[model samples]
Every structure is written in structure tokens, then in C-alpha cells.
Target chain A: MTGLRLAAVLLAVFAASFALAQGDPRRSGYREMGPALQKMQDDDAANPAMLFVQAGAAAWAEKAAAGKSCADCHGDATASMKGVAARYPAFSAEAGKPIDLEGRINLCRTTHQQAEALAPESDGLLALSAYVALQSRGQPIAPPDDARLSNLRAEGAELYKRRQGQLNLSCANCHDDHAGRKLAGATIPQGHPTGYPIYRLEWQALGSLKRRLRNCVIGMRAEPWSYDAADYLALESFLMQRAKGMAMDAPGVRP
Target chain B: MSRALAALLLLLPGAAVAQQDSMPSLTGKPGDPARGRAIVANRTVGLCLLCHGAPIPEERFQGNLAPSLAGAGSRATPDQLRLRVADAARLNPDTIMPPYYRVDGLTRVARSFQGKTILTAEQIEDVVAYLASLKD
Candidate 1:
């Protein structure tokens, strides 16, 4: 081959390899944690999230204002609620958009039980979210293939790449570009939403995905979206889609 | 009057630096390399090691998210370093580095950090000096 042709072929091959290297393999944040934290997540007895799960279980059976409990309509959670969490951020026909597991819980409360919606990050909300999420502990995340969700999911992907705040960073900059690297003392994880209602060491309590998302925005010195905002729902849908096929690690432990 | 003004300036931690690509020394005095080194090495204060790998041997897990701080002295002048450290967004609008000396035009700044720059004017000088000394 001519020297110019040979060089052109080699350049193309190099470019392909570089692109492959840039594509991050899908990996859960659980694998990025320390052994002690991993062990804490692994053991149900040791997991702090279990406390919330127990509370949720109690709330599930208790009669609400309308004189109906969650169990009254759904029956045994172990059988009925299995794999439900894995398919969350589902298209809510009533809301005309996607609603996450927490949203679903609140919707059930307001509509079926005639109760007020639980406040964001409240003990009651965290408890029920943890309890329901536990049922799908090891199921692979399966975002629904509803065409109605296409727009919000796309918006979410755009938000992930959009730079914001004083620091001018996008989610891709830290979670995608710098995953597996250290930022101060902590390693920047790939930031998959495999875990929700996670037990964070910094928080000393269980918190939802919305809470985690808000913390990230604050860290970037940006104004966080309000609770149950469509933007939050969009991001949650995108994260769930991005984490497709990754096992659910709800009530996860993190430092 | 000058004495009162100087005292008032002392109370304000992060006095304004010129809004330019290259800026004069923030403290109007040459920075102390030793003090600069201390700031760069500090995990919480400077947070330089969080994004840039520097010559600090004690810090094992230096970040690789941004450029290495090694040979920074040769790459840019002291004036350029000052501006980059104070407000890098002026140079690159999408830079992830936080503005160490700028205070206004930010959104939703945490309650404790409102109206406060990330670093003092003197701290910015120290950081710039430390970065300017990384010739090798």
C-alpha cells in the first residue's frame, strides 16, 4: 500500500479504538464501594435501610383515612409487588407523564386511601419506598418501552449533558468522564440509579433518588428543582433507562 | 482615611480581582511558595488536588479530571495563573473549576456560602504562586 493510504487506514483504526475507550462500561456504584460498605448492603440485618423497610411494611398493612390499606387492594406484597420497582419511572396515564416508585406510592395514597401525599424525604415516604423497592432487590432494571415516555427520557438525557451552575459542570463530566477516578478522598462512581431510598452515611438516614439528585445540583452550586417536578421525573426516567439490565440494589448503603 | 480603608479591606476576605483573562496579583505582593504549597496540599481548603494532580507527594489519590499541575509555571505567566485560579469561566465558559475569587452572578448559593467567594484574595495569590512555581 502507498504510504498515505497506509497512514489513513492506521488513523481510522486509532480513532475507532479511542472511541471504544471513551465508552464507559455499565457498572453499578455498589462495585465501586469499600468492602465494609458492600458487606453492610449485602446483609439485611446490618443494613440501616432495613429499618425503613420494616416501617414501610407496617404502613402497608395499616388502614388509611378511606378505611383501606395498601394490602387490601394489592394482597401480599411478596407475591404482588415482586419486580414492580424494577420497572418504575413508568408512564402514568393520569399524570400524563412518568412517575417514579415514590410518586406511585403517593398516587395510591391520595387516590385510593383518601390520604395526603407524603412529603419528600419524610419518614413515611422513605419507609414505603424502601419497603416496595426491597421486593425488586435483585431484578434487572427494565424501563418500560412506552412511546409516551420518549420525550421526557430524551429531555433527561439532554439534562445529563447540559452544563449548569457556577461550576459549569454536566453530569457526564463527573459520572461519565471521571468515573473510577478520585475526587478528593472519594472515588467518583459511574452514577447509575441502581439504588433508590439508599442509606447514605452522610445523611444518617434513608433518602430517595430525588433527594440524591437535589444534592448533586447543590454540589454544582445550582438551584435544585422542586420536589415531584417534571424535570426530576424526567431525570429519574433517564437514569432508569441508562441503568437498564443492571440489578436493582434498592435500600443500598453508600458513604 | 487610608488606614481606615486598609482596615476595611482586611475585613473583606475576597476583594475583587480585575475581570480579565490575565490579572495582576490579588494581594499586590508576591505570594509565599511555602504558604501556597500548604494550601494546595490541604484537602478541604484549596481542593486543587481534587481535580488537578500536583507535585504534592503526600497526596496519593490526586484527581485526573483536569490537567496536571506539573510544569504549570512554564505553561502560563503569573498573571494568567491568577485569572485562571480566580475565575476560570472567563477563559473557558464551561470549565468545571469553581471561581475562587468571584462572588456575584451565582445561583442558589448555599446559605452559609452566600456572598462569599470560595477563597480569600490572599488565598488566591497563594494558590497562583504555588501553581506558578511548578516549573518541572
Candidate 2:
């Protein structure tokens, strides 16, 4: 090839490789968080999310309306709950639909413990979710592969790409297209769920993945879904699947 | 068409239809650059600085997701800028930038915000005028 053609070919190859590199699906939100936030996530004692973890452990042991504690049925959390969070938003045969970890917890509560469903984002729910997710910290995210989950997962993928809100923005617009780019002085990370039940410094409290989703919808000037909405569960399934094989970083810290 | 004919055409219902069917043409009293600058920098109003960097120095934490508006006047005409701020999706089907004025085709809008534009026509004009002033 002539010199100009050869240079053009080299540029094309470089551009293709650059695009491929930028499309790394396994990129975690942890790296986008600055050093201070990283330190907060790394140290259990320093992590404010750990406070919720402790609270969750207490809730697990405390007797509820039926005089039955979670420990009574499930025994020690570390043993029984290991890797559970990584597999959630999984298809529930009982519900005959996909259910997230929070939903499953509420299911167990109302059915077996005879307790009322905890309100979404309530301290009790956050604590329990953080505690359970903390147990799966080192486990790889492995959302179930059941056929029942496929429909919801597809719906979720659509939601992730569908533009809503007056902003005419979709989750993919920022989290996918603009990941690693700065937005409002913060880096936009891929919308991964690995670090959910995270303690956000902005929130000054622990929040669930659904809460984060709701905030995004609101930020886009779109109406937000109610807590535990089917759409949220579908999105949760898609996010977890997107972060599959990445280690769980629950009870995580975020800015 | 003549200006009078076009103005008369706009008076008929649905005669204003264009490439972006839902977006209304922005035409009104001239915009004030000073007021425009304030709107763009305001966090709750224009919110331009949140995802766009501008020449404003006092606004800390200006974003870099979108192009800097430092010399936007030299880059594009005021009319072009008006359309972009009004309904950017018409220009690029996939833009993270929010439509500052269009109200239709949105989902899940809060009850109070239903049928509301993020900026008024005058505010959009003001922003466009202010942007037009930012020469390199």
C-alpha cells in the first residue's frame, strides 16, 4: 500500500481497538470512585455501610411477630446466606416471577415470620440487605440462568436502553455511552450492581439498588417507579447479569 | 414562502409541524445576555453547567460530559443553538443532553412537572444570546 493508505489502515486498526477497549463490560464502579471513597470501601471499620451490616445482623437474630427469628429457619447467615446476594433478582418459583433480594426477604418475613412487609428504604430493610449482601462480598455475581428470568432480563435490557424522561436520556446514554466520562464533577461509571446496598456519602446512609435507580429516573426528570416495582426488578436482573463474574462488593461505599 | 405567509401558516392548527413535530418554534422578545448567563449558571434552572463547561469562573464543579460552551458563538449560529437547547434529540437521536424546552414524548414525569418545559422560550433565547456572546 502507498504511504497515505498504510497510515489510514493503521489509524483504522487503532480506532477499532480503542473502541473495543472502551467496551469492557466488567469495568466496576469501584474504580470510578476516587481514592478517599476507595479507602472507605476497603476498610470494614471505616465503612459506614458496616453500621447497616451490624444492624442487619441484629435484625436477623431478633424475634419477629411469630416469635421466629431468621436465624431459627436459616441458621447462621455466614453459612446459609453465602453467595445468596450474588444470585438474587432471581426467578422465584413461589412468586412465579423474578424477585430481588429485598423482595425475597420481605416474602420470608410475611410468610414465615408473620411480619409486615418492611417499607422500601426503611432502616430495617437497608440493614438486612447490607448484612446479607456483605456475606456475599467475595462471591462472583452469578444471577440465575433460569428460563423464567429470560423474559424479565430482556425487558430490563430494553429499559436500560429506552429513552424516557423530559431529558430524553436513557441509562445507556450515561452509564454505557459516557462511562468513565465526567458528569457534574463525578465520573460516570458503568451502571453495574456489584456494589449495591452501598453507603453513599451523598445520601449519608445506606441505600438499595432500587433507590439508586429511582434517583436516576428523577435526575432525568422522569417519573420514578414505586419500590419493588416489577420494572425495577427487571432492571436489577439486567444489571446483575451485566456484572456477572465480577466479585460482589456489597455494603460498598460511594460518593 | 413570504414572512407574512409563513406567519399566517403558523396560525392554522398543526401548520407548525416540522421535523421535530412536538417542538414549538421559539420566537419572542430579544433575550438579555446578562439574564441568560444567570439562567445557564443556575443549578435549578438552566443547569447547563452541570454537564457542560462554560466561561463562568464562580461555578465550581463544571462538568465535561458535553462540549464546553466557551466559544459556542463562533461554532454555530444562534438559531442552531436554539434548536439544540430546545430539542437535541431531533438532531442526534442518542444524546444525553436534556431537551430544555420540549415537553412531549417523555415518560414518568412528576405530576407537577407534566407538560412543563425545563426552560421558557425567553430563557432559551437568553441562553442562546449569552452563548452567542462567547467568542474565542
Candidate 3:
């Protein structure tokens, strides 16, 4: 080929790749992890998140002061909770807003079990959420099609694009504009929320999606919203809806 | 140096402190290019390689999020380089690059990172010197 033709071909290739990075065909963070981490996530025996799941199992059976364990109301989580996590950040008419899987667990604690709410990212909370989420592993994410969620979900979509912090970056700047690109040694995943209560290698423990969101806000050098902030639920609602139909990989291992 | 000591030094007579401005040396002395290069190459500390590609061959994976550092010296003056390293937001508020020498005006910074800039004034000078040396 002539020099001009060769240049044209290279430009087309570059443009195509850039488009692919910015557009979807969405991928899970799991697809971006290294083989070792992938193996760690795949093997139930090796996944560190399972430790929290085990703890959650114990909590599920233990009766609260009101003499009701989660088991009493829900029964055998393996049967009762399957696919439940996939539909979370569900609308709660009692609270008059959406609530994440963690929030739902807390709601159950206060109302059904007559137990005190677990602190955000607390060991007990992580364990219980992880356990509940594990039941939905591999199920396709199916956000509720409720109209009450529309406004909050829109606010979340706005927040995702709005830039803030010392870095002046929006979630879309890195996760969408430059997804699949390198951020030093790390590959920037597309910021999907398929997994929750994941075992982050950096954290060396199981943590909720809210914890990850808080970390990202800090990374952007922005003030993180409080744990119970409507913004967290809004973002969660938006992310689940955005990731609708993707497989749930809760209690996931990540680096 | 300990951050506490660095903080102490900034309070001393000749620190030349300010997140804005391009004229003054942050440490009031010419930075060592060798030291600057080391900081740029460090993944956990400097994190420069996380966004900008430099001519550091030993580093297996350099970033592609920003312009290559290959001709940075040829492209910008030492003062301009210092300003960009210290606080690029002054030039472009929407830039994704963090303010390496800025400490004030940030909201709700984490406990560990609170009251701390991403890079110290001395380190900013060092990074400037290193970028200045990359003429090619």
C-alpha cells in the first residue's frame, strides 16, 4: 500500500479501537482480572469472600433478642434467597426510597429480627450481605421496573457524569471514556456493579459496593457521601439498572 | 523526609510555598533530576506512570491516559512544568490530573490523606526537574 493509504488504514484502526473502548459491549471486571485472581474468584474454597459468607450463615440462623433469626422468616437461604440479590436497590415503600442489598438486610434486622442495625462495612454486615449475595451468583441482574425509582435513578445517572474533587474527574471520565485503558499497571474496568460485597485484594477483606463507591470518591479527592445518603442508593439503583441482564458475581474476588 | 518535617520546613523562612505561580522553586533550590526520575518511576508513590508515559524502559507498563513525557522538556519551560506538576487545575479545572502540591480547598479528604498533598513541595520540584530533563 502507498504511504497515505497505510496512514489512513492505521487511523481507521485507531478510531475503531477508541470507539470500542468508549462504547459497549459491556464487560465484567472479572474479565479484566489476571488469571490468578480469576482462579481465586472461581474456586469457592479459595475465595476469601466465602469466609464472610460462612459468617453470614451463622448470623442467618442465630436468633435475635425477639427470638427470630433470618432463617425463621426466610428459611434455607440456598432456596429462599436465590436471585434475590439481582433485584436489589429495590424500592421500599416503608422507607419511601430505594435500598441496596445491605440496606435491605438492615431493614430486616430492625423490623423482623428486632436487632440493631449493623454499622456500614462492619464485619457482621459484610458477612450477612455476602451470604445473601452468594445465593444470587451467576443470576442475571434484573433491576425492578418500578416508576418510583425513575427520579432517583436519573439523579444517579447525573452524578455519574458530574465531575468533582481535586482531580476534577467524573465516574464516566475513566470508567467510560477510558475503559479498557491502562491506569499505570492497572486496567481500568468499565465500573460495572455486577459484584457486591466483593473481596478486594487491596482491602484484603470483603466489602460492599458502597465501600467501593466511597473509595472511588476518595480517589477522585472528593468528599464521600455518608453511608445512608440517598446518593448511594441512587447510584446503586442506577448502576444495577445500567448493568441490567449482566450476571451477578456477588461475594466476588477482585484486585 | 517525614511529612511532619516537611510541614515544619514549609513554615520556615524560605519555603516559597503556593499552589499557584510558576516562578519560585518549591524547595528554594534546583531539584536533582536523578531523584525526580526515581519518583516518576515509582508506582505506589509518585503514580506519574499511571497516566503519563515516560522514557523509562525498565517499567513494563506505562500509561496512555495522557501525553507521553518523551518530549516534555522540549514542550514546556521549567516554570510551566513546575506549575503543571503542582496544580494543573489552575490551567484546566476539568483536568483529571490531581493537584500534587495543593492541600487547601479540598473537601472531606480521608483521614490518612487529610491535610496532605499528593506530593510534597520538594517532591514537586524533583518531579519538575525530572520532566525538564526529558528533552527528547
Candidate 1: misplaced stretches above 4 Å? Answer: A1-24, B1-23, B26-28, B38-45, B55-62, B68-71, B87-95, B101-117
Candidate 3 Cα errors over 4 Å, as ranges = A1-24, B1-31, B42-45, B57-61, B79-83, B86-94, B99-125
Runs of candidate 2 exceeding 4 Å displacement: A1-25, B1-25
lDDT of 2 by residue, B7-51 (tens): 787776554434334333376566889999999899888989878
lDDT tens digits by residue: candidate 3, B67-104: 89998999988898988888787888777777788877
In candidate 1, which residue pairs get closer than 3 Å at backbone N, Cα or C atoms, i.e. clash? Answer: none
Per-candidate RMSD, Å = 10.5, 8.1, 11.8
Residue A67 lDDT, candidate 2, scale 0-100: 99
The residue-level lDDT of candidate 3 at A237 comes to 86
TM-score of 1: 0.80
Write candidate 1's Cα lDDT for B50-121 as tens digits. Answer: 888888898888888789999999999999998888888888876778888987767556665677787889
Top candidate (TM-score): 2
User: How far is A86's C-alpha from truth in model 1 (Å)?
Assistant: 1.6
Highest DockQ scorer: 2
Q: Per-residue alpha-carbon lDDT of model 2 for A1-255, expressed as tens digits?
A: 699999999999999988966875657878778898898899989999998899899999999999999999999999999999999988778877778999999999999999999999999998999999999998999988788899889999999999887676889988988888877788888878998899888889889999999999988878888885789988998888888888898888988
lDDT by residue for model 1 (A1-255), tens = 699999999999999988865674888889899999999999999999999999999999999999999999999898898889999889888766678888899999999999999999999999998999999999989999899888989999998888756555678889988898878667898888887889999999899888888998887767788896888888888998999888999889988
Rank order (by TM-score, best first): 2, 1, 3
